[model samples]
Target: MPLFEDLPRDIQLAAMENAARTTLANRYGITPGAFTLQQYEDNCVYRIETDTGPHTVRMSVRDGRPPHHQASELAWLDSLARAHTVTAPRPLTTTDGTFITETIVEGLGPSTVAIFEWVPGHAEPPFREPGIAEGMGTVTAQLHHHAQTTALPDNFARPTWDAADILDRGYALTHPDHPLLGANGAAVLRAVAERIHARGPIPERDRGLIHGDLHRENMLLTPNGSIAVIDFDDCGLGAYTLDIATVLSSIHRLCRNDSEAYADFAHRFLTAYEKIRPLPESMDRFEDFLLLRDAFIVNFVTSSTNTEVATWGPRRVAGLIAQMQAHLAGDTYPGTLTS
Candidate 1:
């Protein structure tokens, strides 16, 4: 079992793409062109057309994760869909009667893959249209509300996004100490960690099943003109603020310190979020979660074998650190507003 990193960059990507296509053709018994490859990096996402119509297939990602973690995601996704609080890509069981199964990608070895109904429609541009935030907020609140009320199966298992998770990812962001992080960046990381520590344990009410990576790209504006979420692979139990911050995190990057634009988004989302579920008056924890998400990405990109992410990671981390500094100085550009 050769690790993805053991191979050179070009070799790693070529091998993955080839393996993905082969896995679909062989294990899934799909012909060539049945699945159009949408992404070829950490995971190979394809728009698959089958006898049952259209679905998305994710394959050729990290093979290291245990299969049960994937099963837990499917369990919750099915529950969310049934509850009608939010629509997620429903998992389709494989020929073998299991939703989450493994496929051997020849030279790449065994990799976990699953099929999901393609939630149609393009990604809503972050805050491009007025009231989009309200719609997103309403949907998020519904998701949280449902999560709070639902009971899980006794055997259900999911990871926690906590001190341990942060520590696990911290090394990747710190190692070789990229020139981008520099001295100020290092200090900011330390201060943010301390602030998070001072908050004590996250309150139970503020923690539940969250769409752990709920950025614009992972969203779909369905034909019914509703916001549908996709890619729950990162879904887990965590701070409710973490989920809220994930949405704003992408908007923050897009706004690039434009306080007015960021404030508009914050106002709309908070106003609507509170309509369905209570949102805290003080959004001070927003910036902390933003930093946490950024740190996670830095670590994610660092570990990825994808050439593009490897090149972009350092610069993105540096930019986020600078924004965090402005936030500490009371700039509070994006997620710190009230309507």
Candidate 2:
């Protein structure tokens, strides 16, 4: 009986799988035939096999959001599904008709678990691929459109992802201070955050529910040529441009070696997004949001307690800081086009 963190990798996974199975049987009444761990870093994500089909079960060990936040995510997903907008993963309730289950793992303490009917699709091609970036744009706009017209339920709750939340008060940079970033890197991050704050308030019309982590990996390409968005764990109230910047910054990092390809991808994405909804106002400050996206990643990586993930934190934070420094110096942020 070792503490969860002290257990060997395989042993920890076995314990998690067992916990998932037990939870599924007791809560959902679906005894799974197979269970596979899909992600092990920030959260424990599993692919469970059932007679009907596959479904995904997520175990949130450190989730601190209120119950309303989880409810808010499922509500939006249901709305998008019914609206026939972009395909969103539909959540399943427990046998008790509750959306969330409070449970404890053998080694770990309390955790929040939920299940989603497995989204039917595969990962999309690289952003450099033609039409791929455009598809991301179209799907993002579809979500924004739904958010704009729909009325939020009175009980709905979510975080507001603004410059201060993501950057100025980032978990890694400020929570006892990240060792790798030190003082200078922290200053660089604060400088960018200040510029974003100085841009003034976001228009009422420009703020809405957004997929705060809508990068390439969160998207899937279905058989019928539709883009399916997954992982609503980070959904929140934010400026629409923040979502756009998330997508653009992902492409920029992936295509860092090829400026031409990055430009092509950015052009295609923005052009297609405008076709759906007018680009969020104040896009001149779009690059600022892009830097914010990088800061978000830095916080995510450095805050992880997982040893494997923490091992990569330094290098990852370093790379992200380099990009931020370039933006701070007024040099063209990579993959950003002035035209």
Candidate 3:
């Protein structure tokens, strides 16, 4: 089935900022916040500048996730912040006094729009400073611990990250016969997924709400040397290792050309995280989770028509496929964790 975000670039951009700001102005009877496009990956992010203070307005094409699910995710973030689990973005109400509002576009169907008080600090690169990796580890442990003990809301519901074909089937750019994946390539993808699952079902303690996409850009490093996590839009029920795998896959893809750089980052991040909460023995299954995470990225890029991505798609896709092969073969990685 064609995904909801299948709208062409111009149409998608047209549904954002300018229209959203005008709608807000008409509803609230006040000046709307000035909006500048921030990012355009899974969602259309805008930096909202107002005289009062800066905020953010995020619009996601309802690719099966509706306003309610987005609201549930926001509610969870609010709770996490209140309980000191981690510094998180707080939901901003629209003029209708709701955290999430639905906007029906001509052909794209209904999209979810929400606002958040922007976090002040920047998300530093993982290798930017000495303790950056350690900080990521420390904060991620705190989030996992929170997911373990907190009482979630009644309406809390989101799909598990591991459900087969969830991303591949839903992505508009991918299908069983896509040229990039080739013909037998479809079979290869499923076989790897099955092999990963055969390792056995995850134990109860190892599963819970996860920030499904915590790669570097999704986080911010505040001036006080603390972490401010963002983009919980992808949070859902899954193995805690799913979260680790997401970050690990990021390190591998980013430093694919430099093994030494990968080692330095993997060590500091793993060492600091283990210091807070010892690496779960369940982590022996980490490579499996890594493959799953990398597959998610590969699916997104190949399926996307983003101009910049399309420009480099051929090279990037090949590199990702190679990384996946080496990862599954246990070849491209260094020590599992650095001391």
Candidate 4:
């Protein structure tokens, strides 16, 4: 596990060469220059400057995560861009029009890489800015609205937000005598399972294409206060309300110290979104959705190698378990799902 910065120059060159060939950069005089790595849990994103400006080359090590996945993702993104749903990174194609290049890193496993035209903007902290909620809400509504009519390819895997899936994932966290498994973990798993059972099965009619992950960190902001959404890696067919639930859960986490601000942000987001898409009568199920969303985060952080979560997982899990207990004990938050 060599850190991106620690990789020898030769390996970096190989990655750069692979990117150039795949993106058809030879045709546009685009040669890789200095590179910086932005590594996430499942992939490594290299920001490579070329003759044509900056482009991103994303490499995923886990099998089934690249080449085909990249191609499918770019197709969906291209559709969204054409429909003006939101600003997404445009995939750069080679002279042959292929979307990915296969490459091998010395210490890391084999990877599939793709080049994307860089999207310029900065990410603003949503909890710190009240106005951002409206923009986010509006963008989310528009995204869902557009996805409804967009034709998906045969291989597109729709996201599953079913309660059964959530519970099964949580249960998988404790396995084969892993040291992290304990009474505390067991309790959390049980709580999540009980919540899922109480919620019943996810309604079949509510399924649609959703961004899957809509936290504030995934949005970019321009100087004029306009926003652009990115990272459709999790985009798939699922409960549309689950997207709203993800945003609300993120708001809760962001505004933990300022309850009033959290309420304000939630209000603004819902207000703007409803003006466009108008929540369904079944939106009353949001509380259940919130519970499952929080559980998913808990399981993901505990199971992942993400540094931020690695440092913060224990405390966050405790807080979330407490919140779940409170909800189970009849504590209620405002905002009716029916509204």
Candidate 5:
């Protein structure tokens, strides 16, 4: 079955109209002609040409599960725009001003659709330049600062980061017969969970609204040398340190080959961030945060029963489990930024 055919008809229509309005007749003064869909590792993005130029429309899928927090996600985006924090895709509204249109497709479950003005740019490749690192750091700091003040909706689900939450999910992923399950996975997960629990909850001073996922891929570099951050789907209220950890982990993943170059980049990024929002006094726990981040990814990837996940999840989970064991056993963790 074709991917989109599973989306409800109304949602499909809304998506098409959103593509038309945002890219063409609304501000660009031209109509869109033919549209083509680009499937990424995570979402289905469509590119259409308008009289003004070409624009892209993104639609997120749940893989096999139901839509995850569609209403709350849109609400958070609206709140961010209202607060005037940073430039985010304002939900393209209909004549009636509703953010999403729902529809029921035959084979697929209910789906909600929304649109936004496409921001154009390319992802900075790994180890490009130290200047890029500074740019990323400055923007991330600004984003965290803005997020700190925004009031999120009541139902905004926080990122699953609590020690118990991590352990519970970790066990679920490592259940016997699961391909990703390993002898050391459960033990490593327990150790991390216990360490976090013993440290106690993060004090309110270190907790705030954060872009739970702030990797380089989520940022776009425009022709004018400006950077635009996109994809607030993972935005939530969490430890500010976790946000920093996410960025650091992503940099390490992308620049694994050129440690010296990425180390320079990481230093520049962190320096810029410290200038804006200084790292918490508890920043000494950053190594723990990094371990938590890696373990969380391992659990998520392994728990997913989706075929797309099965191919790579097991191996990656095993690798992370081994690394965590080594760390716990006094081996220095490998990465650009060490404790």
Candidate 6:
């Protein structure tokens, strides 16, 4: 039999869910009904149903992200909600008025748990819609503007998404010697990492709190037609271009069949973004940003405990290597910046 971490992701999630059932009543003072597991990646997200309305409970399954980090994420979300910068899911406090509740899961160790008010919107809508890219750009710009002007709590802390952290460190986390990444694939990754480092430090204006994972799935289309960004689980400090690269890479993957649409999507996003704030001059080297994002994806897939992700790791790594090799050859990959 496989170990807990090696077990199928659904089994692991079910075990964790069973252990966490008491949390809803004891921490958030709600009688849980139909608590369905929504996501089981670095964290476990449960879509909890109640008489009043649905809520979201996120449990950090790893030890690397401490309670303060979770609190800091909530702090930024709260700031965005208060400033009306964007429609972000707001965190709900426990019965004791605290942001996070600590609990021990069966296989996973001590975990940080937080409940959030359900964000209203359609999930995973088509990104190629006429206005979808524009909405993403607008909401992203709004969030960045708020981050630049507003002051986060002094204790606010999240992982930095710099070159070393984003590329080299992530690759290392995925295990440099992993069989999926043969000598050629490993060399391509190293070359991309070197290019990222050679780009030098980010200019002060370009560096700030960024939603580290603002891909298409993370942006929700609200009923009023506004874009609502969710899943702040990866929000952190980094160059604002990181967020741009995230969405653009997603567009590249999703729109691979139509380069024309990809170009239009990139154009619409940047145009709408500039309407609020000028893009960072560093965007001249946007390929590095895209490659950086690709590297992160490789690490995420390779290191995931989820059996589904594990199964996809080899193919995903191969695609990422091809993209990296394309860049190294001075040619454009599907995700290379079009506009």
> What TM-score against the true fold does each predicted structure earn?
0.85, 0.94, 0.85, 0.82, 0.79, 0.94
Off by over 4 Å in 3: 1-15, 26-30, 62-64, 95-97, 105-109, 124-128, 163-174, 302-308, 326-339
* Candidate 3, position 210, lDDT: 89
All candidates' lDDT scores?
0.72, 0.82, 0.71, 0.67, 0.64, 0.82
Number of backbone collisions per candidate: 0, 0, 0, 5, 1, 0
Best TM-score among the predictions, by candidate number: 2
Stronger candidate by TM-score (3 vs 4): 3
Cα-lDDT of candidate 2 = 0.82
Q: How far is 36's C-alpha from truth in model 2 (Å)?
A: 1.6
Residue 77 lDDT in candidate 2: 85
Report the C-alpha lDDT of model 1 over 1-339, residue by residue, as the tens digit: 666666765575566556656655656665435656677667777786766678788774664346888888888888887887787888877656676777666467778877777787777544768667888888888888888898978877777776447643465545636565667766666666776677767667688888788887887777777788888877888888888888887776788568688878877877899999898422556666776787677556555666667677777777767876776667753454444
Model 5 has how many clashing residue pairs? Answer: 1
Model 6 stretches with alpha carbons more than 4 Å out? 6-11
Q: In candidate 4, how many clashes are counted?
A: 5
Task: Give the residue spans of candidate 2 off by over 4 A.
Answer: none
* Candidate 1: regions farther than 4 A off: 1-32, 167-169, 173-187, 280-284, 325-334
List the lowest-lDDT window of 10 residues for candidate 4.
171-180
Q: In terms of TM-score, which candidate is stronger, 1 or 4?
A: 1
User: What is candidate 4's lDDT per residue for 252-318, written digit by digit as tens?
Assistant: 7666677777777778888999988877444767887777677677666656554545677777766
> What lDDT is obtained when candidate 3 is compared to the true structure?
0.71
What TM-score quantifies how close candidate 2 is to the native fold? 0.94
lDDT of 2 by residue, 1-339 (tens): 767788888887787777888888899998998887788876789888999899999887554566668878888887887898889888888998877786777788777788888998887456766678788889999899999999998988998888788886678658636687866777888788788788887787888999999887888988777788999988999888888888877777777898787888888988989899999885877777777778888888777778778777888889888878887887876555666
Query: Which residue pairs show backbone clashes in model 2?
Result: none
Q: List the residue pairs that clash in candidate 1.
A: none
Tens digits of per-residue lDDT for model 5 on 1-339?
656544554565455545444433543344666666643334445666755555555554445222445455666667657766455665556455555554443344444455566677776534375367777787787787776766666666545554455565554444634556566567667776777678877777887776767766777776666666777666655677877777778888776788886678778888988888887655667777777678667766765544556677777888888888888788766562652
Q: What is the per-residue lDDT of model 6 for residues 27-137, given as tens digits with 9 covering 90 to 100?
A: 878887888877776788898888779888898875457888888999888888788769989888888888888887776667788888888898765776778889899
